[model samples]
Target chain A: MHSQTPTCGSIPPVPARAGIGGKPAHYAELLAARPPLAFVEVHPENYMGEGGPPHAYLEVIAEIYPLSFHGVGMSLGSSGPLDRGHLARWRKLIDRYEPALISEHIAWSRVGEVCLHDLLPLPYTDATLKLVCRHVEEMQLVLGRRILVENPSSYITPKDSAIPEADFMVEVATRTGCGLLLDINNVFVSATNNGFDPRAWLARISGHLVQEIHLAGHATIRSGELELRIDDHGSPVCDDVWDLYRETIARIGPRPTLIEWDTDVPELPVLLGEAARADAAAALSESPHAAVA
Target chain B: MLPLHEFQAAMASYLSSPPGPDVSHHLKSMMRPSLRSVERRLAVYKNNVYARLVDALRDSFPAVERLVGEDFFRYAAVQYVSITPPKSPTLLGYGKDFARFLENFRPRRIFPIFPMSPISSSVTSKPITRQTRFPSASSGASETATACCCIRLPVF
Candidate 1:
């Protein structure tokens, strides 16, 4: 096995400021403008190919800014064994880029032979917790790093779920010595849809364990009288999520935050504008009287 | 309660199957009580799974999606996804068999006139994004603390 820590002497640490999801649409402008940002996060699955424009673009981006490999296809919550080949490819990319941070969802995407290619929810139980923790430990052992596990946005909560989502995340982090990537929008989405308080969920989490935070836009899907917030990440962050984000910063202090615009990715300025808003929120939170407001 | 694997297995089956009373009944036992219709809530996952893969297919085969209108393409895609779900996490070549599936889905369509060679070339080459003018290389080195990170198992 390679050294537990890959040779990352050259990469800068991600600053505790706002960043945007790395998109191919904005590569030219990103390179041209060279916006004042902390880091850029990308899905490693997109760069798994051997030699392509994705690598070429990422190579240049990696050279300039700190990178966070936000993996979407790891399927960490699956009950079965982790896929070794996927792990190896991820290891290869991590070794090459030497990103500042890395993370994956608590949700699973693959089941048996079927790769659903979407993050699916998992029940929270003792047995399920053990399985996720084991998988997380194995992932850390293989990659030689303490990866952050993100909370999933829920549409359906399993009846067998015994542990609360926040406690489950804390337990996984506690047991595996990993960190948490708190997606604040997901907290709000799950809270609204599942009938819970987003703030209480945030308060339940161990703030120190949270290494990074994600802010994304969600869409509301209404069926008859019921309206459900879908974590679509295709628009600007709503005011409610932004309020929660501000509260989180005030409560836990600022972490390396991200503006995730995956589906309907806008121009670089729009994303940069959102990042600026995040920075503004963090700045406000740091004020001496921020607690009062 | 069902074992973890059994629950996930059932979830996969339920999500993949068509949304109907029978399918909703299968998942009703697993899901918690909600104020809204359980079927609508469950449909979110089904929509997410199908929509995500369909978007991936559109990314891979934009020409095909264009050749057959969005509605037709989506109609065909749902059928293909139902019969043959992706087996790998790497969606780069996930729809390798889509052209073949299209052949079977609508044999009478104008597939013959379509330039199969270029589309195949595009797939093998795999250039998903437009070419960007890369800036001149600037080498800058900075020092910071090192931290390792990991996540769940993944398949290529």
Candidate 2:
């Protein structure tokens, strides 16, 4: 039986600056450069397998930089139970690496047995709130640390949603004693697709609970006559999303922000360039003049 | 208020395929902006789900997809989804079955992706057969046991 006991000592926290999505292509470049990144957030599932280059590179990188274990398969918002095996696999990574932050989404991609990898939307209702809180509490208890729940970028708002998206996230954070991931691009994407003000979105959420920030790019697709924005993560962080990020940083103060470029990932330099821009944007919020009373 | 799980089930069904008349009749009424066609609104999620899943297949079976072209690949993806939906939460290893699916798929037989010499996904560099008959270049395959991206396929 695998020991659930936590033997690893405490690791340093992630710096409140900028980080890039830990892609394998850039692993060598990242190790050689060792740029000024607060931490590298990786999808734990990618490295869950046995000894391979993915783990080898991650091990070397972990030794130098703080690692954030961002999970995409916990299915925190599902009405069904969490996958025990998946959680066990994640625990192994966390125990080995002693990552600085652990996070999952506020969306449900599984129901009963069908497991869709897409980060599908969840209705903002008491039922969902209760389901998500139980899973979050259980995950935190098992993982032995509070996990942040991220807001999803949705294409369509489910009909008959009683709670607002931000309000639902705030409630999840409050009840589970968990933190928020606060993906700025999601706020912008969801707002643009569903028609809402993103600034007000930050106002509704409990910002203090926000532990990390995600800045990712999205793609637009045409569906019938309507134009829809999909969270494709295949391009650069748009100019408008960058504007929202600066505002979010100014309000939430500096946090460990990640530049997530999953598809058509350009060269390592391109991602580093994005990370550098994020640092500059967060630095502005850190400026003494930008502080709010 | 609709049952959350029931609503989610209907939504899931809709994402997998266009909603049947019976399924849409009740599910459509529960959504907001009733004035707008519910089908149209639901189309957004439908495209999102299919496009993402299709992309997963495209990534895994790029040769198969490239060989057959985009529309054909999408058709194969649709059939694959109907026959075998993903059982995992992450897309990392979602389309492991597609290679075999393509081989067995009647339409793909004409292209002969797998000519007499079965090119398996072996990780090592050992040649499958010392004596090999190189498949025609038009087949987009080679008889040599080449390890490409950990997938040992006979590629040209």
Candidate 3:
């Protein structure tokens, strides 16, 4: 079993600023410009392949900027053992890149040997909670450091759910000692979809447990009478989501926030501009000007 | 009250044989009307899953869809789903068998040259090549076999 040795000794504290999902199209210009970004977040799956452009570009970027591995396919909530192959690959990447942070979703994407491409929801029951905690413990052990688990933007409420989302997450963190990657946009989407208040959800989870934050756009789909916002991560961050993000950061103070634009990825400047906007908001919240506004 | 396994089995059956009359009867007793209006509404959920899966394939393999045309592509997709349901929860990783299905599908063989030319060319140009390595049947059986083996070779 792998164990975490506190590597925080030599590593600088994670910056309290904004960054963007590192896309290949923007690699050169981003490195050349070295625009004011706290760090870059990458989907570990994209870099899971052997030596290629993804690595080449990431190597160049990592030299000048901090990097975080935000994985989408670990299936941590699955009712199965951890994928040894996936963990080994992740371990290799971590060894090479030494990302400032490593995170995965609090949802499952696989069952048994079958992989589900979607980040499917898990019932918030005791069985599911135990399963997820065991997986997190295995992951933390393998990675040799703590990881952050982000709340997934759910589409449907499971029939067997026995606990509130926030409470479930809190319990998981308390049990496994994993940190939170609180996606503010997901909070807004889930709250709206499930008839809960976003503010209350944020209030339920704040401070030390949360080590990072995520902001992304979503699309609203009407399933019968209920309009659920799907976290497509394919567009500009919506104004309402942005406002919720600002409020969350203001209340919680700043963490390493990421502006994630995955589908219709704009130019480097467009993404950097969004990151800058997030930085400005975080700055305002920290400044006296925010009180007046 | 149905057991969880029974419910999952019913869902699997409904998804597999959606248009079959048996689905409606099974769905009627199992699913709450409030949860999903009726069998018709349940059909919509099935449709959403299929549509999303198909869209994912189309997005990932535009050239293949373009070569087959929209109507034919959808028909083929339905057949593909029935034969090989998505193994991965991630739709992006599904449809690994579509290109093979096209190669063996007799109806599509009429187009004869469809597998090469425009479709294969377009796919090679995309950033999604990491997901699939579609083969051209015109390259002869031995070559096709070699290509298939190469494509199936896992990345990591």
Candidate 4:
């Protein structure tokens, strides 16, 4: 069995500042400009290949900056058994890069034989919660690190759900010894979509458990009589999300925030600009007078 | 209370093949608001499953997709989805079998490789799986595989 936690101590920790999602377009400029960044977050699954340019670029970048492996698969919510092979591959990446932080969504992507290539929300029942907690524990044990579980944005809620999203997450974290990657944008999107208060949602989470933060752009479109906010990290961060993020920083004290612009990725300067904006916001929250604001 | 796996099974049916007459009544009870609202909500997941997976195919095989033309590419994508919906979370290896699909694709080969070339036959084999490497030749310009990444799952 793989060690429950990483045995090596090679990579440095990420600073609690602003950074961008590691996109290939910004690779050269990221190295050339050497933007002031806390760290870069990459989906670890993308680097699972035996050898390729992704690994090549990531190798050089890993040496320079603190890395975070944000995983999208592993289907933690599945009723089916965990994929041991997938876990081994992920462990390989973690062992090689020794990322500062690692995280996955509080959702399922597969059940039995079917693997839907998307993050599907799970019903927040005791069974489901326990299921996720088991997966997180297994993941942490396999990788030998307490990984972070992210709260997912939702367009629909399950009728079987009896627990509030925040409480469910808190239980998942507390039980598994995992931390939270509070994507403030998801809070706003999910709350707005489901008719809840974002502030109260944030307040519900145990803030101390939050290890890192994700700030990203979402696209809102009308769904029948409803307006659904899709977590499409394509565009610039909107004003409302910025407001929530700034407020979150005030509460959480600037956890390593990542400005995630995944789709329709713009130039490095544009992403750097967003990171700068995040820094400025963090700066506000850190100022002595920030509390007054 | 609905059994967790059963709820997921019903959901899987709803998303994959669409529920039929003898569908789970628990599905409607499991949702809120009205029946129409339930459908509107469910459609999001249904659309997402097909669209995202199709997009994953479109992403991984962009050059081939372009060669086959948009409509035909979309046609092939839908067929692939129906036959082989992603069995894993990551899209990393989701479309690994696409070359096999293209091999039997019936349409003219979209890839630049000529029919005469020996590499074309083993498009689905492990040799082509890891960039086309002819062992006989020491070092020269080699045909590189597409660098695949997109969608929520960049790997499977």
Candidate 5:
């Protein structure tokens, strides 16, 4: 049987700078090189497996750097009850790793036995609000700590969404007492696709509740007259999104930021370069040099 | 006054059968121009959804695409989408059934000689093989000798 550990009472404090998602490919180099960053984020599901190389590498890296557990599964916004087995697996990993931060998306991707494998959007209605709050409460109760909920990028809007997207997020955080991940790329993509100002949307979110930030790449696809920017995460961070990220950090202050690149993964140096860029941006915000400029 | 379920049902229907009668009225109400014009617009969404899923499959299963060529793979993918639409919301987990579908597909059956290979074949030409040989060659030889010695001791 695996040993259980107690969840700490308060949110773990982290450096207000940059981090890279923990991947096995960079395990040795990350340990040996010790890149200049705040912390490392990892998908909790990847470490949910039994004893193997992944766990070994993570063990070594955790010794050197602070860790955050970001979950891609969990389906926290599903209308159905949370998956008991999935929750159990996640709880096990959390107990083992004792990561500083734990997070999941504010969307559902499962119904009954079928797993959609995509971060499906939730309708911004009272009914959905109740459903998601119940799920989040159950998750917190099981893990014994609060999990940050990240906003998702949506392609199509539901016909009967009654509340604004920002209002809905605020309501979830308020009702569930969970912190926000505040993915800037998702904000830019959703606002651009749905005809809304990202800055205004960012303003609506309560800054005090946000605990983490995410930055990533996106691609644009044109269909006749309309242009849609899909959150592909396959290329370099766009200039406008970086500007928005910098601006958001300036308003909200620095949080533990992450650089997520899941598709067409580049070399280790390239990803670290992007993380270094984020570090530079966050530093510039804190730097006395920037105040002079 | 359209309910959310009804709208989703109509979308599912239209995605399954493009320009179907069930969605024509709804599309007209939701979109501008006319019902005919709405048909064109709805077709765009249908294409977008299918294209995204196809590209997703292409990324996950590039070897499958290379074996069948882009045009043929895309045709098969479109058909697959129409027949078995993604029931999950996680786009990353959407293409779980493609490998099984490719196995029995008549079009893919034409290429019977395509071998099962590792994902890193682009860099290395050596084929990976599985073996279950015993660790000790002497033990294997001894077992073989004991079986034949009882029958005949004459041999060079």
Candidate 6:
């Protein structure tokens, strides 16, 4: 029975600047350099285990930079009911970390009792919209905090999907009063695979409801004659994704951007280099001259 | 068009199932028609799901992977994943029964003798002999002991 009150007390929101995903491998180096970052983001699932070096490092990191919790396993959009035990674990983690921004994907990874462990796509329909809103509201009720839901990088569109992806996400945010974590890379990936314009998807999103942004790299695989872009987060943010991020920030007014490199995580400096690029790009986008020109 | 749960169930089955006529039928039924082939689109999710689960197993049992090499390990992992899909939401501590799975894994009996010894040690650093002596006879009790043993023996 974890307490609902935040033990860490009130914390400030993550600033609208660039941050890097907090990887365990880079803990020591990150502590040593103490690079100037707006915030540091981590997947709450990684820290859900018992106390160890993960907690030890996160404790110190949280003190220096505003922390954001990007959860991958909440299965918020599942057809099944929300897992109360998993929600309890999330509650415990939130009580301890008190991340400035908390987020989960608008995708389901579990079916019945089996956890598939991938951000499985959801059918865009009235039923899914209502189910996701209920889950988001339930999550907020448990954590006592409003969370941002992220759009998934999709490959296949279900035949049953009735609404468009952008409209579905906006509806979720609108109904639940939850914010949106707009991943520019995911938009590019899904747009490329599903034959939709990424810019058009962005246009449908309400900028006021967006709280943070994500920029990551993807892998391109040739499937027959068609190319598939996978949001693996394994490489540097490509030029196309950067352009999308710049345009997003320029339009959305600079949310707390994160440079995510999960798979094949590189050294600290390389990640920091990406974060620096995000900062530079955001600065350029925010500049009046660039927007005007 | 399938309902949400029915759609997810079909998608789940397709992700784990081997590519064949059955898979082709499943894809065409559930997926929307597009310029790209349905098989190709479904293959992306299949790769992501299997790769993620296989990587979790690899992380838990590095010694098994080393003894069997990447290709064989992947082959065994795919089989194990098909038989025993993950139940936990988080990947951490997800593949505890993998060492036991390797013991009965039929294709590569040649590599079985080396896996349980070093792999359990690799996972929890506990000696297998010491753990096997404890009273863990309940359901999934053996799996718990084998999954994260507390005893450690040097890998010979």
Evaluate residue A222 in candidate 3 and report its C-alpha lDDT on the 0 to 100 scale.
66
Tell me the TM-score of each prediction against the true structure.
0.88, 0.84, 0.79, 0.85, 0.74, 0.88
Q: Which residue pairs in candidate 2 collide?
A: none
lDDT of residue B81 for candidate 2: 74
Residue by residue across B24-112, what tens digits does model 6's lDDT show? 57657777776467776766666666666675566566666787888888888888887788776765566667777877778766654
lDDT score for candidate 5 against the true structure: 0.66
Residue A104's C-alpha lDDT in candidate 3?
91
Q: How well does candidate 3 score on lDDT at residue A181?
A: 90
Off by over 4 Å in 2: A1-9, A291-293, B18-23, B34-41, B62-71, B91-93, B109-119, B122-156
lDDT of 1 by residue, A17-90 (tens): 99987876677778888989889998887787764556778888887788999887889999888999999999
Give fnat, all candidates.
0.45, 0.27, 0.05, 0.36, 0.05, 0.46
Candidate 6 local lDDT, A11-120, one digit each (tens) = 66677888997765666667788999999887777676663656777899998999998887889989999989889999999888888989899999888888877788
Better candidate number, 4 or 5, judged by lDDT: 4
Cα displacement (angstroms), candidate 3, residue A104, comes to 0.7
Clashes of each: 4, 0, 11, 7, 8, 4
Quantify how close model 1 is to the true structure by its C-alpha RMSD in Å.
6.5
Residue pairs with backbone atoms closer than 3 Å in model 4 (clashes): A4-A144, A5-A144, B90-B155, B91-B153, B91-B155, B92-B154, B92-B155
Evaluate every candidate with DockQ and list the scores. Answer: 0.28, 0.20, 0.12, 0.26, 0.06, 0.26
Badly placed stretches (over 4 Å) of model 3 are A1-8, A288-293, B1-63, B74-78, B85-97, B109-156
A1-293 per-residue lDDT for model 5 (tens digits): 11222246553577988888775555656777898878888776556544255576778878888888888678787666788988888788878888888889887655565543456556677877787888888888899877889998865565557788888888888877888999899899888877689999998988898999988888776655667677766678899889988887777777888888755556679989998898888888787655421
For residues A159-264, write the lDDT of model 2, one tens digit per residue.
7688999999988887777889998888987887787898888788766988999888877756466665666676789998998888777777888988887655
Error of 5 at B92 (Å): 12
Q: Model 1 chain A — which ten-residue stretch has the worst lDDT?
A: A1-10
How well is each residue in A40-77 modelled by candidate 3, as lDDT tens digits?
88877666544355577779889988998888778887
What docking grade applies to model 3?
incorrect
What is the alpha-carbon RMSD of candidate 3 to the true structure?
Answer: 7.7
lDDT of 1 at A17: 91
Prediction 3 global C-alpha lDDT: 0.67
